[model samples]
Structure formats: C-alpha cells, structure tokens
Target: MHVVSARERLLTAALDLFAEHGVSGTSLQMIADRLGVTKAAVYHQFQSKDDIVLAVIDPALNRLGPIADEAEAQRGNAARREQVLAGVVDLVVGFRKVSATLSFDPVVMRLVRAHPALRNLQRIRRLLGGTAPDPGSRVRMAVIAGGLMMAGADPAVTGLDDEDFRDHLLAAGRRILKG
Candidate 1:
C-alpha cells in the first residue's frame, strides 16, 4: 500500500541511504532506486542532493525546540539538567539510525551549523550547566550529545533489543549527567 506522498517517500529513502552511507557516499540514483523511481523523479521533488539532505534532516532538527523548551521550563538546576539529558536521550534514541550521521557526517554537520533551528544549542548548554561560570558544562553537553550518537551507532549495543537498548542508553545518559 502507498502509505505516504512522493516527497515523503523520497525523504524517507534518502534518510536511510544517508544513514548507511555518508552524504558524500549517497547518490540521487540510490535514493531513486530505493523508491523505485528515476533520478529525474527524485530531482522533480528536490533541486539538488543538498536539498534532499536538508529535508531528510528537517524532522530531526525540528525536535530540538521542544527539547530545549522542556528543559528550560524546569524550576531547579538539577531538574533542568535531568530534563535536558532525558530529552537528549529521547532525541538520540528516537532517531538512532540517523543520530550518528547527524553528529559525524561532515555535510550534515555543516548544514546544522548554518541552520537556524539548531541555535538552541546555546540554550541547551545554559540548561545543562555544571557550575556557575561552568567551563565543564559545555564539555559535558558535548559529551552527552556525542556519546549518545556514538553509542547508538555502536554495533556492540545492537545485541540488546530496542527497549533494552533504550533503557540502557537512558541509564548511561543519566550516569553521564551525574558525573
């Protein structure tokens, strides 16, 4: 059954390919083949590979706002810290297949750096502070974000099912946040 629009199908396929192969490695032809369409058809929806990459990343990027807001709304420092960690864990675990790519892919990382939606990184840092004038807080936030991406992509973690993995990842994130 046809479950989604053509653009959605293209985005989905491009995301899968981008995850498997870095943006530099994925081609429009591969995306077309995944959707059983021609390269021209894919082009009809997106002007360039970069456009498809941006679109495929939009959903995940869209998630950062709510996460930042949820963490920022908390009353206490500890509460805010925990919320930030939880939101990050959910974001990473929810987008496990693409999380690593989002973190490490040069193309995606460049786009993210330019994208306005991700400006919330500053707010996320403020919310996850370690101590006043906290130099460690920034590093802590980076570690948590980077660690989740690496862990999610790690083959060793795959032996556990999704629920188990999610549980373990969340646990590890909590420990990381505490230390």
Candidate 2:
C-alpha cells in the first residue's frame, strides 16, 4: 500500500476545509484537527495559512501551463481558441470541487489575483479568446470562464454522469466562445 505523507494529508484536509469554508474561514488548527495531528506539526510543514493555500492551489494552477502552451502552439486563431476552451473545460471539470470553491471564494480569488500564477491564468484567458480590451469582451470572458467553473462545481448537475456533464459543459463553452 502507498503511504500518504504528512504534507499530502495536510493538503487534502486543507482542500476539503477550504471547499467547505472559505480559505479565511479555514484555520491551521482545523487542518491539524482533520489530520489528527498537532498544530505545530502542521506548522512544521507550512509556515502560515497563506503558504498552505498557495501550496494547495499551486498544483491545479501549474496544470494550466501545458494547456496554455498547447493553445499558444496552435496555428490558427480559431483552433487556438477552441483548444483553450476545451482545455479549460477539462481542467475545471477534472478539479470540479476545487474549481467551484475557488471560483466563488473571495479569499482565494484575492490571493490568486496577487500571485504569480495570475500570469498563466491570464494567458489561458487570452488564448481562449478572452483578449479583447473592451468591457463587453471582458464580461463575455467572465461569463464563459466563470460559467464553466461554477457549472462543473454545481451540486445540481452532479446527477449527470461524467461524459454527459462534460459534453454539455463543452457545448456551452463552445457557444460562448463563438459569440
């Protein structure tokens, strides 16, 4: 059997708590409690809540690098846009709970906006045809991206099987991109 490290345990517990409560609402003590460890043990692994939050989110945000690269490598605008939309949909659906939690969480959003990861996120947005500087274009981008994230995270759609959920989500994303 594989052994789960203490750090992994902390991250898993943190993600769960962050999803249930906003990042600010989740404390290191809570994570330690969830893991049946002492707070000092958790601190040994991570210096602060911010560090824990960044560590929890880094893996998911790091995935955007390859997805963005693939879209950027596409030869045509339409193809690049389509590739990005598809990639974003996949990423969001794959990390459904995290995507939903991060999408609506003000604390996560603030950290994300300030963090270096925002660069890759912006690249993904631009590659997905969200590049227009106009306010309307901005709104469209938000609607499409936010909609996909929220939809995948939504409890209402959990009844659908994975394939069907992905199909509907992809179709909606395609329509939004085309507009």
Candidate 3:
C-alpha cells in the first residue's frame, strides 16, 4: 500500500483549506485541525504559515521552470511559443485543482509575485511576447495565463475530459498568442 508522509498530509490539508478559505483566511491551527493533528505537529514540520504556503506552491514552480527552460532552448519564436503553451496547458490541466485554487488566491498571488520562480514565469512571457512586447502582446499574455487558470474552474467546461481540456486550452493559447 502507498503511504502518505506527514509533510505531504499537512500540505494537502493546508491546500484544501486554502482553497475553501483564502490563504489569509486559513490559519495554522485550522490546517492542523484538517489533518486531525495538533498545531504542534504542524509547527514540527513547518516554521510558519508562509513556509507551508511556499511548500504548497514549490512543486508547480519547479515544474514550470523546466517548461520555460525547454522553450528557451527552442530554435525559433514560433516553436518556443508553441512549446511553452503546450507545456503550460498540460501543467494546468494536470494540476487543475491546484492551479484553480492557488491562481485565484490573492494572498498566494502576492507571495508568488515576490518569489524567485516568478522569473521563470517572466521568461515564459517573454518567450511568448518577445524580448520587449508591445502593449497588445502584454495583454495577450495576461489573457492567456488568466484564461488557462479560469478555464480549470469554469463549470461550463468542467464536463470536458483532461485531454479535451488540454487541447482546447492549447488551441486558445495559440490563438491568443497569435494576435
């Protein structure tokens, strides 16, 4: 049987709570409660709530780093852009629940904006928009990113399977980037 680690359990509980209640609304004690553990158990694993928040987002950021790196290594702008879009679509679809929950959280957004991994996101945007994008390209990038996240949570499209969702999202991203 597969065993869940204490740290993994805590992070999972924390993410569920963060999704239900915004990050600012979630407390360490609440996380402990969700995990059916004492607050001390939580403290034993993480220094603070911020540490837990970072842990929750770290995996996604780690995955995104590789996507941007691979895209950057591509030969042409079209190839780089397509690669980044496909990779991002797959990432978002695969982690739909996590993406939807974290992307819309204001507190998480603030923390992520200050994170070092934000650089990778910027690199991806640059790859899509070029070295110095015009106002239109900037807007397009924002729309594509925001759309991808929002699509995951969108009830109308939730009926679609993962492959369909990924395909549609990638196609939409390509259309947006082409504009």
Q: Which candidate gets the maximum TM-score versus the true structure?
A: 3
Q: In model 3, which regions exceed 4 Å deviation?
A: 130-133
Local distance difference test values of all predictions, in order = 0.79, 0.82, 0.84
* Model 1 ranges off by over 4 Å: 130-138
Model 3 Cα lDDT, one tens digit per residue, 26-132: 99999999988899999999999989989988877777789999998999988998898888888888777777677777877888888888788778778777455
Best prediction by lDDT: 3
lDDT of 2 by residue, 30-105 (tens): 9999999899999999999989988877777877888889999999988998888888778776777677666677
Pairwise TM-score winner, candidates 1 and 2: 2
What TM-score number comes out for model 1? 0.84
Q: What ordering of candidates by TM-score runs from best to worst? A: 3, 2, 1
Per-model root-mean-square deviation over C-alphas: 2.5, 2.2, 1.9
| Candidate 3 TM-score to native | 0.89
Worst 10 residues of 3 by lDDT: 129-138
